[model samples]
Target: MTTAARQPIVNDDMHDIITHVNEGHVPELLHCVKAYTPVQDATHVQMTAVYEDGMELEVTAPAGLSRHFVAYAVPGPAHEAIRGTVGEAMKKLGVKPDSRVAHWCLTENRALTAHFRRLTVNLGEDERADWRPGYACRFDVPGHEHGRPYTLRRVSGTTAEVDVYCHDNTLGSQWAEGLQPGETVTARGDYQEVTPDFSAGPALLLGDETALPTIAALLEGWADEHPVRVLLEVGDAADQRYLDDVHLPAGAHVSWLPRTGGSGTALREVLDALETPPAAVWGALEVSAAKALRKHLRTEYPDADVRVTGYWRVNEKN
Candidate 1:
């Protein structure tokens, strides 16, 4: 037998594979190490080599350094077998591929308004969380690496709901377009509570379409109904119905502003002309608008609890 035929072929891409895993897919690599290996606190991991049967991993944890060989039961080329083996390992270990990722099936996907889609997903057996306003679900959609966040409007017994504005072709719109009954969706991490303490008293809540779910949620769960003045801006005039179902306090009022100009344009006028400042101000809108408004609130209404978040930027993809 010739010496050249003695060694097995690795498809001649071992170096590329190693670099990809070491740099690009480090998070998934760490997940596998923590889930399968004994080292739960692995701070860092590196793929040193890839072979036909398995790959060599160097792990750094609190207990010190150690080397591990992640073997593959399905015999194939190193590149082809890597993903399958890792998935199988996770399945065999009875764990998710990543702790932060949770799979949910869509039960309801329908239009809440002319430009909005309400998506209701079934919670997992282990998930029975208490209901709250402004809890958001960040979807791990395709094409968007970091994912996009949609505020949760309701979380009933075994199901959670979020309203998505689907006017544009961005990641949010993409998710809405593809949503259907029984379709699987990946929600990353836990529900982020974005609502400010409404117990502070009468307040002013302002936002664009993206903040409707949160604003509606806050109103729906009105703690004492002190009084709330809401100024909402929507891209489409037809979206005013988004808040029609929200029952408000007797002293509260909601103003639907036209999206004549850029984000925060319509709402900015209302903020500047406030004769008597409310006890608190909460807003979530475009970045430029949020920054200017946030600064204005702090400087003008120094005594009030001013909370403004730049939810999205101009021309934001996700």
Candidate 2:
């Protein structure tokens, strides 16, 4: 039997191609650059970069696959540089300058990971105006479940505060842990969704940590004028202390419940306990809980003008 002559293996090292017989494909090397942009409600903008020319790219288009992109914001100077580099890379890929190609899904280029880490800020002692209680801040997070930035003012602590359920893994909780006092966060606009109209009537406000800031703001703005009833759900007893310490309007009746057993169980229990009809009702919480509360209120108190917001959704990052 004549054995077939063995074919020489072609190693494409110069082109950075690595191949495997079973895979039936070769990996190609490409160039990449780190770029960052500010998206509303994103504590720290995600950091992403562009790869070199002819580099195979996998992107999750709008209404497409789900994936994480590394994103972070930089100063004006660095932003300009990143934009230039990304432009050059896209030019090589034959993409138009104005194209929404930026939406193309690209992994956070690990090669520039060190640069991002170095850019992180640490607010050690300087008074962070943004973190102070009663300080107002706004964000513009589009496609965000909340859709709008309600007024937010710090309530319990000297820093800006937002409470999030451990189960609801959205950007708010992710950034809340790492948030520094002075760091800037983006919001949709200055438009106020529920500025307490003290003259409207007796008001009932309901929400969790996500709604706390707005609640605090409403209370502070209407303390001298409006009679408000506030109902809130918190993660645990620690959160209760935060609410207790805040100075609320004398007429404001505030109540709290722990959100542990289920998402909206605590809120539902509180709503069931209410005997008086509120002139207007407002609330914000995790999506499921908020939806549940909305449905219950609509069914039980049909006449009540209720505004319920899903501050964030579970498992969804944006």
Candidate with best lDDT = 1
lDDT, candidate 1, 14-77, per-residue tens: 6446755675577667766866678889899998766556777789998999877766646777
TM-score of each prediction: 0.66, 0.46
lDDT by residue for model 2 (130-196), tens? 3433332333233355433333343233223333223244443344334343454443323244332
For model 1, name the residue pairs that clash: none
List residue ranges in candidate 1 displaced over 4 A: 1-98, 316-318
Evaluated at residue 227, the lDDT of candidate 2 is: 69
How does model 1 score by TM-score? Answer: 0.66
- What's the lDDT for all of these models? 0.76, 0.45
Candidate that would win on TM-score? 1
Q: Measured by C-alpha RMSD in angstroms, how accurate is candidate 1?
A: 13.5
Clashes of 1: 0
Candidate 2's C-alpha runs over 4 A off are 1-151, 154-176, 179-191, 195-198, 223-226, 316-318
